[model samples]
Target chain A: MKIGAALCVLLLSVIAVHAAEIATADRKSGFEFMGRDTQAMQTDDTSNPGMLNVLDGGALWERPEGADKKACASCHGDASQRMKGVAARYPAFDATAGQVVDLGQRINLCRRDHQKAPELAYESRDLLALSAFVARQSRGQPIAIADDARSANALMQGRKLFNERMGQLNLSCAICHDDNWGQKLGGTSIPQGHPNGYPLYRLEWQAMGSLQRRLRNCMIGMRAEPFSYGSSEFIALELFLMQRAQGMAMESPAVRP
Target chain B: MPFKVEGDAIQRSLTGQPGDPTEGRRIVISRQTGLCLLCHSGPFPDERFQGTLAPSLAGAGTRWTLGQLRLRLVDGRRLNPDTIMPSYYVLDGVVRVAPSFAAKTILNAAQIEDVVAFLSTLRD
Candidate 1:
């Protein structure tokens, strides 16, 4: 038991080292890179396009579903009460699955077990809406991705993927997000690419999107084929991103260009 | 020779007189060709929002010999295995390369020379 405890300490220290290795210069949020007008759009709930998705999620939260005919509200009551701070803890280690599960996966799990509803399609309207709504409950809450023993390995893996160069462009996420965040890439100001403002509405996409969808967009932009939605790579990457943005305020329904 | 491949590196001429600086500068800013601006800020004062990821190319010509610049453009992995910079002139042994881009160097020989020429001109 002593040796086991020592090994656990050793492993956690390793993860701590890796987690702390994020460049100091990469501390800015993606929101910091937005133009003035774009920044203004995200600040106002009415002007922010992402609020549309969040409002849709509010409607979905109470709607009935499945063989049990129960909505998410049936057992939980008001999400603002029960679901607060929930989004901030996700992409956490799921012991039963023996791997990291992102917020999207966790939501689907609840949908299956509680709502008895069919899983929403990846990036589907209902999924985006629901995620946006739940994440909105945690607005202004500091992000705190899981860092326990169960999550250490996935966090390291995600960190490696973020730094490793891939795609026809031969750029890693770090090149733009970490090294040159305040600079410009093409016409847009390059951001630190944190996951804080996800379930965001993008002007380029002209729609609300989850963090996974944004990851897929970067993958496509790098000219690499995107992994399947909810794939381990995406989950691990999401875990790393959340941990990377560990202390930033949540901005789930943010608007972006 | 436009360039000669060495063990894990490439060597070329300083005074080869092959590439055009005017053409090279144009390609450096072009998104499809040199893509120098994507990761590097060059000597363009009027061009705003230059990248800060890689080192600025403002004094590149004075910073290194033509041979060093050529080696980097040809295959930067030789200098740093983990460098995010692409091997612009290497055409094989890469994984997950796009189908349209497979077996093709990112920049042609002339374009490489052009980029080198442009980079060398950043003496100030």
Candidate 2:
């Protein structure tokens, strides 16, 4: 009886440790924590314009749209391996450029440098589609941003963006999201501003969009002058939001009311 | 059985229109329009497990006088420095928001009274 009891206690301890290790695995992987299931990354097939871009992006990856004979597939191989877990770590500071770069900027960079393709317009359908395709490859990976000095500075700037008072509304993101969560602002329930699920399908937007676009919408809501597309401020904000949503699982392509 | 309670609660009518408490109940609970139940707990007949984010309004009428509640619904943060409550009645001159909703407040004056009336009915 004594031996059996001792064995049971030992087994329980082992199980507890194993559970904790699994929970923390994503932190080690350089991705934010995420659910085991990858389906959360799926966009609406018919309704979302982003989904349409996915089809176009997949084709773009395979087809040679550039002047060069080499397609993205020619070099990258199956995206499942070549591009796996790439998107979650983007908006990373590049030492070479001395600036933070998002997946979109990097894709454009690759096009210019390696593929010799003309750069796609910012926030254009081609860009959105390509981003969607690449982001899809990292469906189940946790979103992980580096936490070094550079990332810390970027996060600070992002937090300022979040807390800053702006626009004709005399409102800040903190007022609506932090102070007024669960409360009604206008007609809608102010949801906690978790960036866990992004590139989401918002009802008002009536399409799928990146978190940066959503941030722009929030600026419009506050009546603040929105930054131009592909701004450093936007990228820094993205890094901050992803870090805030650190432990939360990726709910990319989530449907919002 | 329903019994009339004397001056249970009263509020100033913005549009000089008396409000129906029953209609007010429907609006507060409705998910799309008012959605007050999402954050607040009251003597809502059907709702259970009220959200834990804010204080329950189950017996708010007993705690605050009708006039006090009226000011709160109009704009509560004026009383509390860090209130999350949105002003439901008073216009943007009191609390400015965006211009698109300039002519709008969450609830009209009538609706505020109606909600207050419904709140007063909760004795237990």
Question: Which number leads on lDDT?
Answer: 1
Model 1, residue B79: displacement in angstroms? 3.9
Candidate 2 chain B minimal-lDDT segment of 10 residues: B1-10
lDDT of 2 by residue, A1-257 (tens): 85775566567556533321112332222112223332333343455445666677889898775677677899898987988777777778877667788888888887887788899887677787788888767666777777767767878898888776655434567765655555544324566666654555555667767777888788866545677678878887888767765655554445565
DockQ metric, candidate 2: 0.08
DockQ leader: 1
Give me the TM-scores of chain B across the candidates: 0.85, 0.72
Mind sharing the TM-score for model 2?
0.62
Alpha-carbon deviation at A103 in model 1, angstroms: 1.7
Q: What lDDT score belongs to each candidate, Candidate 1 first?
A: 0.79, 0.64
Q: How far off is residue B22 in model 1, in Å? A: 4.4
| Interface DockQ of candidate 1 | 0.29
Give me the runs in candidate 1 sitting further than 4 Å from their true place.
A1-26, A95-98, A186-188, B1-17, B20-22, B43-49, B55-68, B80-83, B91-95, B117-124
